[model samples]
Target chain A: MTDATLTRPAFRRGVPPQLIGLGALVAFFLTVELLIQIGVINRFIVPPPSDVIGSFGRVIVEEDVFGRFLLTLSECLIAGVLLTVVGVGGGVLMHRYRLLQQACETWVAAMASAPIVLMYPLFLVIFGRSMWTMIMMGFVAALPPVILKTLEGLSGTRKVLVNVGRSFNLTPSQQFWKILFPAALPTIFVGIRLGLIFALINIVGVEFLINFGGLGQLINELAERYDLPGTYAAICFVILVSILFFMTLEKIERWLRPFD
Target chain B: MLTPANPTTQAAADDAILVVDNIVVRFETPEGPIVAVDDVSLKVKPGEFLSVIGPSGCGKSTLFNVVGGLLSDHQGTVNVAGETISGPHQSIGMVFQEESTFPWRTVTDNVAFPLELTGMPKAQRIERARHFIALVGLDGFENRYPGELSGGMRQRVSLARTLASEPKILLMDEPFAALDEQTRLLLGDKVLQIQQALKQTTLLITHNITEAVQMSDRIVVMTYRPGKVKRIVDIDLPRPRTSEIVGSEAFGRYVAQIWADLREEASRGMRDEEKHTLEHHKGGAS
Candidate 1:
């Protein structure tokens, strides 16, 4: 029995989804390039990949893109941490008290559907087109997803598992820490993914609206000056951020999901 | 219903280690109170492998929960080691059908969970966890996370974790129901061997007739919803049992007897569910 169970090899051959996504991405870029090369689409409207890459290099050398990139990444990281803590904490509390959950139902519904972009004008007035406004906007925009996901996770906790925990003489604290936390992790990660994507979009959107110092701000400056190649280059950087954020979260989910 | 008030009942007579008297569990629903376990009672002797076999929604799991003190809204009294069960008592351990192994923790940490809850020192908990790990034949995989293990191995870790607590009574709610046939059979024998070695008082809930006959000293057959005990059939087969006994004439007899009792109960359950569906449909239409 042991030998039969153990003999199966890992890394079985198949076309995995990650490879498929990469293929599709490359195909998209190629098509866009073909369109531009054939003069079907104006180069000014959608800059060619070569122009974007060249403009990206110039920005890296002149604008010290690393410094600005670090600032934006730091804002996202800090905001992500804050949103996770607050959202999960609130979810736990609300799960314990159904009344609090009920009270937040309407607000959560409103936040889910409401345009997060509307928050930029108010943030601009308060923080006056600064990094704080960008950070705070990211925090607020990301908070809803985290909260909703966590609540859904907690709500879905198995009754049998909870009873099993109790039967084993686990304290309430132990129950939450051991069973509740792990059981809720997959959904919580999903929430984190959504929150990260939203926060990235909001940070960039707010940067454009308020003229803050980030890739979004750079995109606005390039567009105002009609530097389409530079605009596309900055947009590529934003896309990279989104892809990296999503891939990192996908990695985490795989790490947390049960094996075999 | 096994209510304690019926003093003359043969089922109530015993020098049993655990006695559950007249348990009636109700769930508060939007419509009204729905009774799950209706006045069910039983006696459990020490070092006995008892199986509670019932159809779906027969409240067997609910009974196990009440006995384990995991359910609080029961009308009857349950005593473990002569003390009334108010909440989870330290003397009762549990295993459920679904994997409750924390994916974040390694197998050793998962097994050590109950010990950690009791504030046992880390070294002692690890030691005990390892002991049970070996007991469940999962020695080398201590450092592996629950996610890294197969379904059978994960359930073994859960069993190890429960056994590590060294509770006087172990409550298992269809713990192997999720596994495939081969894994279930293997684990069934493994669990029996371990239980015999340890002389643990086990109350297993399952629907598999053959499994109940193979592992149990006594099998309690329950009726349909608002479940009550239909009968308790005691098996006197010689111990140091093996899978071969499952095909034996005596084991077949036990299976036949239990099936005979279950047939009526199953028909009643189907009728009840049909009635419930009709009412639900009517309410929806209204």
Candidate 2:
């Protein structure tokens, strides 16, 4: 009963929240553009919306923005998939084994709290400051939340459900896959979404700091050369990528729990 | 009444499906070992509907855990379906409170789960799950996730899942406690209908006296903490218990009988808890 109500998102498809969120986003951007055009803000430094749009277009046509976007996307995807695998796998192991949960608790906490950007240099030393380093950094940052979420999620699974699994003479594996996992899904996805966002941010942040080959790296390169418009364009691209990632994840969350 | 022989030999018997010997359960605390269940014994005859009723912490659940092979430290043995239950046995199916129906699984998948473990092919599992789902009156909602259904509906799914396993014995732990009263009655009757059709041996643990009386052929009233069998009342009510039975004088008599036995145990349990608390406080002050 506690679990049945939890699997669905708080807001439904036709709710006012979605409408309000979209309306606010459009209004906020329009107000900013209007302020820039009316000279309330300095165009020289911040640049107007039109100029930003033009630069974005130029970057798309000349600099192969889609290819670079795909590159960044692929890295995030690889890191996300890897984080899920390692995180869920480790989580289940830890959950099933009480000693492991206790042993990994402090380690997971330390990894979760440590500055992922700082690890970029260490990864760079080891992996030579390539995309692999960025991915690893993302994984390190993302992994703790994923693992923690998995533990919390699995533990949060209703005692009622576990008893049910037991009643059916379910094996440990069967119980986990059928009962525990499903019961803990909403919380698991919360961890996954948090992990995805963390991984994306960390990957780009690492790329920016280490000057690797993603949009973040491009933004850093453009800024150093004082190509302000190009930097602006790359920043826009990053924003778009973040939005796209969020939307895709939201869609996936919906698909996984459709009726909800 | 059938009596199982030696625990090991009991399982190999042809008639009795489950035998729960005197099980003693205790929890180790900093203060001392807290006794939860003390010398509880029961047996499930083939196709018998047995309901155990007691107040909270009466160790009814602990008794179920012993039978389910969950608590090994307990002093007892459980034999299921011609096999000694060393651990969870595939021949015995279990249903828990509504939450056990995995929210992520559609009704079909949830029902098919036990079969999946048994290495049944996908098609056969699906077909079997569908049959069970229909048996539980959840035909159209097979594709719906547990999250999409009501509490009663979800419990039905859990029931379907348990039945889908085709286990010789089915164990339910307060499965209807979370539902509204109306839903509980409906589900209870639905469960009774299924049990009648399948002729499955069932053991249900509940706090609801009326539910125990309405559904069970025999009701085992349990004592409070350090639980023991207080009494066993046989329901003389005829089979295929309908909603109309709830209004019958026979049902009222059963409810009153269970309540009388339970009240004394509940009072005793409360006093035990209070005394323990006071002792803890005095020790702290010293």
Candidate 3:
């Protein structure tokens, strides 16, 4: 404590976290750029960071990357919507029914560890290499964690809180919406973030494998033509898509549970 | 219908607002059936603060749950103002031992929850809830969440919530059990002040000797197992009391007397636990 007080007037002072983060990122890219230019690191396998940044405009204009990003974003949003709706609803159902929970909770946990992308061939046959196939793949890959975590969240509500609800004589629906749902929300958000991670990976992976969809297909073509700079640039757009969903999810969570 | 059950032999029944009549609770274990509470009965006069003090595993919580309508599988009836409770009753409110405040809700919102369930208008509920918040001395904390508040402050929020609901009887199961001694005593003083101001009938279940003696008008001591009322000790202290009374000789005497009554039961409870563990070990050996 005394050390902190003594050093209070030194160079150590408050700084915005985002600024420091941006600085670190810039320093990393500059170091890589210098390394590749100095020939200490080969530029064949990995392009210089400057070239990657320089190719961003070309890829966006020539590849119609924004339109493709929007397509991928919409498909992901649909899959995400389905994952939460179906997964949480399924969890709530299982929570309400002990028999169902006992029967299928293990199966859901098992599915979480299984490679869900293995079933893409069947999804391909059914959806015919369209957006539906990718959507279905993302939706399925992301679902298990949401269901398991929803059940976990609902089950984890304090007995005291539920008793308070009951003592007030709340109806079934009111008990759910007022007490159970709100109490379980933080955990449910955790499930959504985890599920979206799996969903986005599978969605982009399928797009790359089939060469017919969004950012992943762009990445595949750029890699095939030895356009390493453009390939990395396209991967940044994929990261952008991820950041978009995560930021929106965080905003919604903050809005819903302000204190937590 | 409940008025007919009032026996003329018991004068307190005529004025009692809450009555627990012959409640019996049993739980079936793998070994056999264990009776938690055996034909326990009590009554609380209107505007009185009554406490039930006992050792752990004495089924004090079982009786508390029965009274609060959280556990209803017991064989008996809990009546509030001549009305029988089939389940969670509107006239009955509970303050629990665990942290009961919702972390997502602000102080005013948590207090306003019961009112919101009753479909009161948003503005009216907020206004009413603020009154109770102020009553519990948490006025400026109306917008703060449970996570933002201290443990004692959060308990105050729950207390305010129960009070806002306007329940005829408040059932508290060791509400201040989690707080430090100083905070507990201070909060206990506040709770007593609020109870007197509202003329609210309260039933408190706790194992703290001084806590039971400090706030209660009367305390019922329960036995270790198959919990039965061992004695009912009336606190003859003056009214409008505060935490200051704890330093007095009379308060210490009351605490000592209740402790004497509870000491044997607490030891018996510990012995029974030891015996059970020993028996389990023997069975494992076999």
Candidate 4:
């Protein structure tokens, strides 16, 4: 039986679905480039892929976009770290204490639905127009999803696994670390990813809104100067940042849970 | 052929490894308080392989849970080797009906978990885990995760983990129910071989009559809920029984007799479930 399964076609075994997705993305970029080169689209409004590709070096050297890129990266890192610590810690506490979860669950859901980004004016007044404002906005915007997802992950742990732990006379802490934490990890990672996404959005949006530091500010400046290629290049950098984080997260997740 | 023994009249031997004194479990649902196990009592001797067989919803699993110390809100006391079990005891290891192997852990790690809790040195625990893993016939698959294995293989991993704890009593709640008949029979033989070799005291709760007949020294037949022991059928068949015993004439007789004792209770359980569903539909319509 094992040999028969191993003998199946390479397409069934070796090729990952991600390769197909990558192909689709490349096709999309090529189509856009083709339209721009044939004059089917206006170059002023939508710069060709070639122009954006060419601007990568110029954006880094002439515009000195690396410093701004690092600033945005640091903001995202700070917010991501805060989300993991606070969100996961809060989830563990809520799971441990039923009444606390019940008391705050509805409030957390309401907060998630609320237009939190609009509260930037209030945050700006409180923290001033420094990087603190952006960090705070990113943290707040990212918090709800993290907390909610953490709670869900912890709660969704299979009861049988917990029972097995209990049967072994495992201490509460031992059970949490050995069984509960590992079992809930995949879902918890999902929460972290969602939180990172929200954090990135809020961090960039806040930068653009206040015309502050980071990639968002760089994009805003390039757009104001009517440097379309440079603006698109900056936008590409934003996407690059997102892709970097996503790839890092995927690697970490695989390392932590190799079987899954 | 083995005949059913009277549990109430049977003397509780001094060498009994586990003693349950009239355990009663009740659960309070929105409907009201319902009795799950009512005054169920049994004594399991050291090195004994006992099987508890009953109708569906007969609270066989509930009784197993009580003995495993997973259910503490019961009325009676469960003593293991003369010590009262208040919570999960280290000497009592349980295998659940559902897949209980940690998906995150490799086979060796899953087996080593109980030892890890006791703060056993990593090298020693892994060594101990490997012994039990090999005992369950999973010699080469030590580093593989449970997700990568078949259902039967995973259950074997669970069994190995439980056995690695070196528990005085093993409580298996339909550990083979999820597997196919062939796998179940094969696993049953493996469990019997382990029990015979180690002299392990085991109590297996299963609905399969043939499994009880093929594997157990004594089969405890239970009635519908509130579950009460109907009879304790002692297998007088020759020991060191294997999968081959299933074809024996004596095995067929034992299986037939257990079905006879359980048939009425099974129908009664079905009737009650039908009535409940009818009432539920009527309530919704009204």
Candidate 5:
């Protein structure tokens, strides 16, 4: 019985949606390239797909885009980590204290829809147009969703599970650790993913606006220099970075919740 | 003010493992304060298997919850082994109707959770959990999470987890209601065997008459909304009961008797539901 129950099927699992999506993306690019080659579409405005693909090597070598890529990656990493810590911590605090939740919940929701990016000038004055300014902007823009998701997850734990904990005479802290936290984990991770997305947008946008550092700055430079294909290649690299972030988040979520 | 048939009931039984005395639970809803359990009382003898069978919304579950310490703000006291319970007591374990097995944890870990709360050593807790897991016949699937298991298997895991706590009294709130009839009966047999072996006092809240007759030493029948204990019927059937025993003539008689008692209350509940639906539709039309 033990062996039969424990052994999963030997065959590999079904194909992932990401693989299918990649297939569709390649097909789309091929169609666009064909249209441009046949002169059915103007190449000046939307560069030929082949030219953009060919410019990847030049973007890496001549443009030295890797350093700028590293800069944007670092900003995103710092912002992402801070957003997670502050958002999850604040969420737990609000959930634990009713008064705090009631007072700040509305503000948090409003902040989520607020035009936080428009306050970049204010942040610039406070932090002096440095990477800190960009990081802080990203952090503020990304925080609300994480806090709200964590609150929802922790509060939404099933009453039956909590009752089970109570019946066993678990202390509040013990109940949180054993029952509430683990159950809330999937939702909390969802918040983190959403926060990372907002952080990535603000980080790249700020870099472009300030003409400071990272892939966003490179894209701005390439566009201004009429290096259209190079601009597209750099933009593609930014998309790759987003994909990597999401893929890593997905792997982490799976590792943390293998059963789910 | 419907009085329980066994009104000569002892408030404090010397051999009683659990005594619920005149528990009245009321909830303040938008409509007003609704009485759920109205002055209901009962006692379970040590190692006795007792079932509370009732019509829908009859407060059998409310009574069960009060006993389980999941609900407070009630009017009366619940004593377990002569001690009053103001809050959740470690000696009392509850199994819920809904699937309550911790999905994030493996079967072994879920069983070992209560043990872990008491700060038991890791190896010893696992060893103890393994005993109950095997008792429920889930030895090999110890490492599998609850999500990977079937509904019946998950409920078995819940049963194992509750039993592993070794509570003096187990309160089961329609724990097998979600399963099919066949699985319910099979699990009922497993429960009877476990209760016989362990001799733990059990209070089961169920709507199934057959289950009440097959597993319980005594059955407490309850009325509809604002629930009151309608009767307490003793099961004179032979013990060492199993699913096979449910087919016996005596078992059928006990089930028939309880069904007869419940038929009126069930009809009333259904009528009330229909009236409410009609009223809601009228309100919508207006």
Candidate 6:
């Protein structure tokens, strides 16, 4: 079935997918580093990989990199928790109530395409220039996909499974928890992954735009000072933060739905 | 020629574990109300393997659904073990034509699910589930997910789950239709063995006349649209038989008789489908 292919990551020919992805990333960094050393690409605009690596310790000690990373991680964590709870909850409610689904499905789906980051000024006014602004921003940005995907997931559960429940005389609550929820989990995880990634991106973007918190803010300050190596170093940490978040999220997803 | 309804239907109901009486289902579409099942009735005696065979779109599934309590807007009274059922009943269990095993669950967990709902203790349910699993010849693959198994194996898992419930009457709707001919025959043999061992009353819905002949004590042939019982042919095959019986003379005669009965109805169904597409095309052209 198409679902079999969609749920499991393809690992063809005895090779793991992660190793291929890692190899590509390393090759990309090496190519850029080589181009810079050969004077094919300017070092001022984009620092060489070796220079960025060399300055990592200095950036960590002088600029408190770990603190910046922690701040971003906390913001992501808070936003992640809010989106998962509200997003999945909203999807279930909307699915249960047809009127709610009809009224909001299009609006919510359209929200996914909207430039939510542009409205950071409004968030600042409402939530103020504190961490709430970034946290709220991430939550809002991530919410749509989670809700939509959850709806998709729940609705996509095969009719046969539902009938199996009904034939066996499952109560409404038991049917939902036992059949509908687990059947919808793979698609829901797709939503969670998208929502978490969106949350992380917007949180960092708000940090950079407002110049107030996290890796985004540190990168902003470093760029302003023309500390190119340190800025690249900080940008690297942003990538690191996202990869870390995704790896952790993936582990959680596996724990929640091991079959996928 | 229309053969009368099962001559034994009235006589057998007293001893029957399951009785589907006068089931008539009408589905309303833009075209208007279309009768799916029309006054069809059946009685499955305990330990009997009965099959309802018909052409595609002949409403065998609709009748199956009505009997299983999955379809409510139907004219029918389904009684299981002397209790009339207006909805899903504890004494009735259904296996479906589609892939129904929960993908997230292991084979053992899937089989143990119904017991879990009843608040049965974990160890007991797991042990009971293991017995059914072994009966279906899936002893070592208990922990594997449905996605990891082949189509035939997954059907076996679902069968094990349903059998674990020990329902008074089991309803199976085209359970092996998706498998290859060889797998279908082998699984059919396996099911026959298990059913006889447990004396499980089973009602299978299918279009395969050979399957009906091979697996059933009696076969009910249904007409096309507005499906009704067209005929009932008794197999009279000896007990403790396998699907290998298909090679025998009696099996061939039974298959031939059912095929002859279903041929006209199948043609009628195909003609209606063709006419439907023609009307749709003409309307779109206009």
Best by TM-score: 5
- Runs of candidate 4 with Cα error greater than 4 angstroms are A1-22, A34-43, B1-12
Q: What is the C-alpha local distance difference test score of each model? A: 0.82, 0.81, 0.90, 0.89, 0.89, 0.89
lDDT score, residue A109, model 6?
A: 94
Query: Compared with the true structure, what per-residue lDDT tens digits does model 4 show for residues B137-245?
Result: 9999999999899999999999999999899999999999999999999999999989998999999999999888888888889999889888888887898889998
What is the interface root-mean-square deviation of candidate 4? 0.7
Point out the higher-scoring one by lDDT: 1 or 5: 5
Deviation in Å, model 3, residue B219 alpha carbon: 0.8
DockQ of the two-chain complex in candidate 5: 0.80
lDDT of 5 by residue, B1-286 (tens): 1224563454224678788888899999975899999888788899989899999989988888899888888999999888999888988889999999999999999999888877899999999999999999898999999999999899999999999889999899999999999999999999999999999789999999988888998888999988988888878778788999887888877888888889999999999989989988998899
* Residue B14 lDDT, candidate 6, scale 0-100: 68
Compute DockQ for each candidate against the true complex: 0.49, 0.47, 0.82, 0.84, 0.80, 0.79
Give one digit per residue, the lDDT tens place, for model 6 in B222-270: 9999898988777788988887798998777777778888899999999
TM-score (chain A only) for the predictions, listed in order: 0.87, 0.86, 0.94, 0.89, 0.91, 0.91
Which of the predicted structures, 2 or 3, would earn the higher DockQ when compared with the native? 3
Report the poorest 10 consecutive residues by lDDT, candidate 6 chain B.
B1-10
Clashes of each: 1, 4, 0, 0, 0, 0
Q: Any residue pairs clashing in model 3, and if so which?
A: none
Candidate 3 per-residue C-alpha lDDT over A1-260 given as tens digits, one digit per residue, 9 for 90 to 100: 78877778533566677878898999999998999999988999889998999999999899999988998899899999999999999989999999999999999999999998988899999999899999999999999999999999999999888888888888888888989998999889899999999999999999998998999899999999999999999999989999999999999998987896
List model 4 lDDT by residue over A1-260, tens digit each.
79879899765787887887788888998999999889999888999888888888989998778898889989998989999999998888888899999999889879877878899999999989899899999999888888888889889999998898888877789888888888889888998999899889999998988999799999999999999999999988888778888999999999999998
Give candidate 2 regions above 4 Å deviation: A1-22, A33-45, A61-64, A96-100, A167-176, A179-185, A210-212, A225-229, B1-15, B81-83, B272-286
> In candidate 1, which residue ranges exceed 4 Å CA deviation?
A1-27, A243-260, B1-14, B26-35, B148-150, B180-183, B275-286
Candidate 6 Cα misplacement greater than 4 A, ranges: A1-23, A37-39, B1-3, B6-13, B284-286
- Give the candidate number with the greatest DockQ: 4
